[model samples]
Target: MKRRNSIWMIILVVLMTISLIGCGTTQSNLENKEAPKPTDKVTIGFSISTLNNPFFVTLKEGAEKAATEAGAELLVVDARDNTAKQISDIEDLIQKKVSVILINPTDSAAVVSAVESANKANIPVITVDRASNGGTVVSHIASDNVKGGSMAADYILKTLGNKGNLVELQGIAGTSAARDRGQGFHNVVDGKDGVKVVASQPADFDRAKGLKVMENILQGNKDIKAVFAHNDEMALGALSAIQAAGKSDIMVVGFDATDDAVKAVKEGKMAATVAQKPDLIGKTSLETALKVANGEKVDSSIPVELELVTK
Candidate 1:
């Protein structure tokens, strides 16, 4: 009877042990089902000319948001409009093994070596609103600046009745937008007999420089009929300078269609401004970047349309 009792006790303990083990596994399974979400570990790098301009600030925000949405880390570095600094920034990001790189080149042609290095490292590059000397990047996204520029010139020339002495304020010397817009305007103005380009100078796309430069031009030239500023900030500066100089006869054209540009157009402070949809550029760029990083086919080129605003 004692032996029978011992056997029964052994069976009971074994059954209890099995029951506890099964319960522990079931609990573990439930806990695992409620485990924390897995996050993707991907990093992207962005190097812009500078955040000194509001347009670039918006662009950064778009890129950051897009990266976060796709569960990636975005590393942004501002080169303060310096070519060497920009190249170094890109190299630093590359060393960190950033999966992708987006650069807004300070000097369009100077970033080529950095791009080639990225290619050798098997990393892809996306250029935003600028192009290198060689087509070394996977994609280039920007507005149709040449067309926008042409529109500005056309509007100015047509409104002035095809006869005006115009002075153009250019942007940063080597940037693609600066070159394209200035040349695009020249394309229209230089061909016309009635339109005379008086004096053109680089203002480095600064509002204060535009004001000072315009003031000098206004003082030096009495027959100034119009001004084409490469950017709205410069245009606004020129408008202020004109008001100060008591030069009310000159019509002013500007680019970038920034909020101030649009407001100036509404106020008739500027004759016309070419508007580039900067926000849309950011949005499309981020979308394309995600596609590129995910091994999906993306558009090699995305062109943002430009509009001319006049009041």
Candidate 2:
């Protein structure tokens, strides 16, 4: 009876060991299932509004550099500033099942449906240099355009000595950057009793349009003392018109200190321009997208710093 009991006890110990080994395997599998490995491949999609502008070109380059550093694949599609094209590009990226998407919207309100499509696909979306009107976005990365606008206005005020007739050149009508910048400029300029806005028109952020608009405004308003363009392109266009008209006394303030704009500032052609870090915005957007892909939490609004560039 004692020998039989000893044999049974040994068998019982073997059974317990096997049971523990099975439990260990199950727990290991569960842990592996719960977490993704860091080495998992990541693919990011970029939908640019237009590469025609040098600013956007720089932004794309920055995103590409960041993607290369992270060992991630970047698929860039240019909308050429077409809202429909942008929406279609986003849908394509969704069908490609990219890990994340970065969009620079051509029109703030028009891109809502496209953004929603990305949401439905469970792909994270980040906006660079612009924002979408309605959609679930992980984060928005851009300069504080309103503040930059105010900065331009303040500079104009100081340059004009608190009293002048000003002309406002607007950007694309539906864009948030255009709206916010115009608001900021008006916020300060409107309240001043001495300064008056002679003419405000949308140049669609185009240099040629800015020139033509300024020429028309000049034809009607000869007393205009200064011009504030929503962007450097328009500002440069306005500058050309002013120069051709032999109006050397007019002060021009612009936003987005692009290379040409900065050169103009240095050469005393333009009064000042609000500097936006387009490269940083692009870099941050890609980095943030990677974090979101990794299931990390991020702020809904991310603002890049702005500076007033002057000669």
Candidate 3:
């Protein structure tokens, strides 16, 4: 009976040890199941205003190159200058769980909702070139458009001897670029007694539109001496119209020193262009996005350098 009792005691000890070991194994498995999943890679979503423009194309290329160098994935979506499409694109990027988002807003006021959506998702947003009027943007990387406009105005004033009739070719009506550039130009040209802005019209930042608008303005304002377009696309269009009308004497100044605009300037067709360094903006935007993803602090507003390209 004693032997049987001792054997039962040994069995109980073995069973308890096995039970404890099993419990430990179960706890280990539970912890493993509860562990957070790791991401395979960082993905950046770039919502461009329009890839149709050469400037934005260059910007995309710059961003792509940087993404490749940094081992990050870049997904580009073109809004085609449509605000609705841009908003939709941001929503899709959010659904895809992109690590970061870079937006080149088509319209400042209209893009607010989309930017706010990203904010709600707790995703960082960086604006390039154009700004959004409302949103929780982590950083904004763009040229000082107002200063650039002033630069163009100063050059135009000097060229025209501070006395001439000017035509202002505006960008998309609601864009910050258009508003700020116009403000800067007017800051200098508004009260000037010598020069007058005879016609200020919107070309919607399109080459063809610029041509048509300028053509219409030229019909009534043949005395125009200079043209200041909000962008190279409009400036080039205006130049085309001016050439067609045999108004070779009118000097044209444009922004966004695009390839065609730079060439025109070198050829003495365009008086000057503001160089926004779009590629650098793109590159810097990607870099900033990465920093934000890493939980690094960045400035709320980042300004890219600007230069005036002239003949």
Candidate 4:
């Protein structure tokens, strides 16, 4: 609003800050009024289950970068892993007239009604890293979790020499990742004669629970040779429990190439971890959301490739 020598221009990015990149107009050459025109605040909603986990944190970073570059406002709400809260957050975003909605759901089935409500408000919805069993979300971007699970299984087989007792540390009990990863591991281990799953327990994707569950499993069966954890946090926690128990016979493998998991892999503490590339997942989701919001055709699902990192 103030045209001082420093040039103070007002841009109303309501919910979040926007960084404008002047590509078509040269700010140095054109007159102040004719130079880079500011874009109106186009608030896009992001409903994240929680900001506590590293994966979700990285996803938020990527989404923020994309939103800033596009001169769009980002309104992020935390559900704190509650389905009801997630639904309310979406409803609030819709009431605020956010241009689009990006949901990293707390529960696939529970979020269906919220997505439907957003749709009724003429707001496009996009799912990131998880899918709803119902509702018409415009686009979905998530890692090929089943394939990542297979990769971990392959690592376990190779590490255990294809014939050893194993344990599975599941993520959040009902999440898609936990189910798919379990299926992938079982498919491989069930076929092998001596490679039996001695224990399979749910850790709820938390390091503390992983430690506790692993501790219990260790007391019951000390002969386990390898463990496949559905997520990096769980795997790392299991690794710590193994160390605390003074056991060196267990081979630990984790999905999600989180920093801790990578360190463990490098130190030979964990056999391998799958790299999901959360930054890419976030960027792709927003770009896809933009397309869907503009009435352009976008794929229902874009699968993220997985990479195995092991030493």
Candidate 5:
């Protein structure tokens, strides 16, 4: 009986050990399960060439709205159309350790250094509405300026019947928008023998400067049939110059369908203007930047749609 009782005791001890071991194994399995990914917040940096223009203001608003929707913070810096200031602003963004950087360059060539600095820091850089001439950009978001420019040219040709003296009020000197738009316009006009570009000058994409330049051009080229300015601000300036000169027959075409430009078109004061979706450009750029920050693949060039606004 003693031996049998001893055997029973041994059996009970072994069963308890087995149960404890099973419990330990279960606890170990629970502890070894994969952890959920962190939900750390991210911040994006946006640098604009200038907020003075209504188009850029719209762009900024779109970016802000997108960042909010994506649960990210945005830090915006306005360069006020100054290249040096733009570079400085980018540097400040880099120092702040933003997850990504979005830039609308005042000068394409000048922004290259700022982009390079971001690249060295391993931060992705995205350009909006403008491109850098010599930097490593992850993506570029903009309308097809060349196409928009060509559309403007086509309108000018049709309006003038392929024969007329023309003046071009250009944008800033070193911007990709200015260069690409000018190229597209010239591609069409140069191919046609009837249209002659009598005067072409940079108004620095400013309304007041456009006015001054157009006034000077009018003094010399009184037979101008049409004026094509890079942006609506310049176009409005040219329109003022034309009105002051008593030239009611001259037609004006501008890019960027600003509210005033659209109103002008409706009022029969301007012939036509190209409509670029600034809000779309801004939103798309911010979204692309976020993707780039997350190690996702993005297209190097994203083209927004453009429309020619006419009366």
Candidate 6:
């Protein structure tokens, strides 16, 4: 009888052990099944040179739309055209611990330090509409400024019959857009003997400055037949100055086919304008930033398309 009891006890103990093990396994499975999954949302930082300009504003809108569509949070800061402020803004973004940073530099060279800082923090940088002169940039999203400039020059040359005294209203002095556009325009006009650039002045990419500078140029060079301003704002300003001076025969060309510039082209007030898709640029910049954040490869330079708009 005692031997029989021992056998039964052994069986009971074995059953209890198996039951405990099975219960532990089930609990672990339940715990794992109830656990939350890792999140895929990422935060992006966008630093713009200025929101004052309509082009930049449109660019910002596109970025916001892209961020929303990608399910990423976007933090935007405006530099207001101040390089120092832009650097500070970028530093602030670093502190926020953004996954990636997209910047439209106030000045290409001046923003290098900011980009380097981002690099040190291991945050990838993407540039839009303008490029940084220094630091590691994963991608640059912008229109082909050189080509657009050449197109503008070609239109001006064709309109003027390759013979005219022209004035160039330049954009910001150090920006890549200004430099490339100026180079491209000069490349064509400089070789032509009939076309003479009467005056080229930096209007700082501002309408008021463009008007004032153009007015000053007009006072000295009265026989100007055509004008090429780096951007539509400056072009419109030059147009205002030209109209004020009572000049009717001068053909004006501008870049950035903004709403006002397009209307001007339609109205036959301006001869031509370069159409850069700022919205596409902004959207692409954000998309590239997301790719960088997600450990994906991106092109160093992404050229957005440019078109020439004429009346």
- Best candidate per TM-score, number? 6
State candidate 6's TM-score: 0.88
In candidate 4, what are the lDDT values of residues 1-311, reduced to their tens digit?
24552343333442124334343245544554665668665778899978877888888989989989987788889898888999999999999988899998877778899999987888988888878778887778899887888888888887677888899998875566677788877877787877888998999888899999999999999698988999888998999999999987788888878888898889888888889988888888877777766668988789987899988
TM-score of 5: 0.87
Better candidate number, 3 or 4, judged by TM-score: 3
Q: Could you give candidate 1's per-residue lDDT for residues 1-311 as a string of tens digits? A: 99999999999999999999999999999988976778667778889988887678777887787767778788899999889999999999999988788888888888888888888898889999877766468788998778877898899888888997999999898899899998788888896887898889988888999999999988888999899988887888899999998888789999887787788779877888887777777767777777788888767778988888788
**Clashing residue pairs, candidate 1?**
none
TM-score of each: 0.87, 0.87, 0.88, 0.85, 0.87, 0.88
The residue-by-residue lDDT of candidate 3 on 61-125, one tens digit each, is: 99999989999999999999999999999999999989899999999999999999999998889
TM-score of 4: 0.85
- Compare candidates 4 and 5 on lDDT and give the better one: 5
Candidate 5 local distance difference test against the native: 0.93
* Candidate with better lDDT, 1 vs 6: 6
Give the Å shift of residue 77 in candidate 1.
1.8
Q: Scored by Cα lDDT, where does model 6 land?
A: 0.93
Regions more than 4 Å wrong, model 3: 1-40
lDDT-better candidate, 4 vs 6: 6
Tell me the tens digit of each residue's lDDT in model 5 across 261-288. Answer: 9999999999999999899898998889
Weakest lDDT window of 10 consecutive positions for candidate 3: 33-42
- How much is 183 displaced in model 2, in angstroms? 0.8
lDDT (tens digit, per residue) of candidate 2 on 216-239: 999999898899999999999999
